[model samples]
Target: MRPEALALLAAACWAVAALFSAPASQRLGAIAFSRWRMLFASLILWGIALASGGWRSLDASAFGLLALSGVIGIFIGDTALFACMNRLGPRRSGVLFATHALFSAVFAWFFLGERLWGWALVGSGLLVAGVMLAIVWGRRGDEQHGWEQTRGRLAVGVALGLLAALCQSVATLMLKPLMASGIDAVAGSALRMSMALLAHGLLLSTGWRGARPLAPMRLRDAGLIFGSAAVAMALGMTLILQAMKHGQAGLVAVLSSVTPILILPVLWLVYRRRPAAGAWLGAALAVTGTAFILLR
Candidate 1:
């Protein structure tokens, strides 16, 4: 498949992952769920890498880079993302994460030296403005009467989300160089996941006190969460790497920004939830902006 196609696929996987993740977090706290998700996903990726001849050909340099990527992107970025989810909920968090696309653009320009087109700049402005309006308007009617309950973690989430985007873009920019230097995609992915697994393990241990979770896990919820992990870790990472390996990371990032748009129809189909008028408008603006960035 083409890199553009793979990027779109990655976006689709993210959309689906978001859908399942919210409920899963509600069942098991976000931190615990994210930890397990990364752990399980790493196992799946390792198995695939071993099967793909990536196990025997690992290089220390590539390993180091991948490990760094995972630490910055998965460990710090993901931890912040979940914290945002817990505090701000999915809608606001998702909007904040649009900043990731902007970050990716900037990082690609710097690291990969990918130049942005005029249309891309225009689209980015629209996306940022639209997302901001959507988030602000969405929060307007919330139960919180003042900014106190609404601001802190939500602000952090937006900041972290932007940082996460930058980390991911840099990771993508680095991937092609590593691959050209003989780093197998599967092996590279495995290395990234392994670092995430290690970090997650330490966090889980630190967070787990003598007491168990406030609520018990259900078997079905466990299955769903694990399944989401597998998809995100194995499938999502694979597609993203595939895209980065062959496509300009900036273009890939812009294309993958379609995740929000992809989620809209899913919400209607899966849960019979229709977005408000402002939401639909925002979503349209986001989609139009993404198209501009991608097509131009």
Candidate 2:
């Protein structure tokens, strides 16, 4: 399959994970949940790397790059995102996070010399607009805490969301050239996850940001966190790295940003209720924009 397809698949995986993670995050606290999830995902990726002999291909420099990317992407970016979600609710946080596509595109253009012009630019704009529309106007289920509840901390939440976007975009751009140079995506993922695990461990140990004492996880919470690790961090991130290997980093980011749009159908199916009309329209616009990018 093409890298674009893989990126979309990653988005689907993320959408599923997001649905499952919210409750666990609420129960465990964002920092605790994120730390556990990263540790779990690191172990999974390490096993895959060992089994596939992906571990043997990395040299010191590649290892360093992958580790740095992991620190930025998983440790910093994901933690900030979880915090943002906790503060602002998923809908508003998601809208801000989607700006990662624009950040990725701009960074890739200036730093990596990857350019998007004409239809690609238009498609990217439309795609971003559609995602923002869906997130802002889409049906709010019971899961999301209402935006009105977050008014007091809206500025902080927005800042954290933008920080998450920046970290994620920079991490992806950092990895693109390495992956293109024949780095093993699985091993690279494992290395990055391991680094992230260490970083989170440090944060927890230092009691940074009032990192609460490790909460006891209920069976359901454990299950949800593990499932999220497997699908979102392990599989989704691997697919994203592979996508960056084969496609423009900006384009991959744009494609992956469709997670919000993709979640509409998932929500409808799971809840047996339809999204608002705006969601349907947003999905159409996003799909049309994606087609332009792909077909152009």
Find the candidate with the highest TM-score and give its number: 2
Candidate 1, residue 123: the lDDT equals 77
Q: Which stretches of candidate 1 lie over 4 Å from their true place?
A: 118-160, 180-182, 206-214, 289-296
Report the lDDT of model 2 for residue 183.
81
On lDDT, the candidate that comes out on top is: 2
Model 1, global lDDT: 0.69
- lDDT tens string, model 1, 1-296? 87877877887898788767766765566666767677778888788887777777686666787888888777777666766665666656666666676777777787778876699678767766666555545433433422114435556766766665666666666666665565666777778877977887776677565212445778877787778877666787778887777677777777776666666566556545555566667766867776676677
Task: Tell me how far the alpha carbon of residue 259 in candidate 2 is from the true structure, in angstroms, after superposition.
Answer: 0.9
lDDT of 2 by residue, 167-263 (tens): 9999989998899988888889999999988987777788576566346888898889999999999999999999988898889999999988887
C-alpha lDDT values of all predictions: 0.69, 0.85
Estimated TM-score per prediction?
A: 0.82, 0.93
Candidate 1 Cα deviation (angstroms), residue 127: 5.7
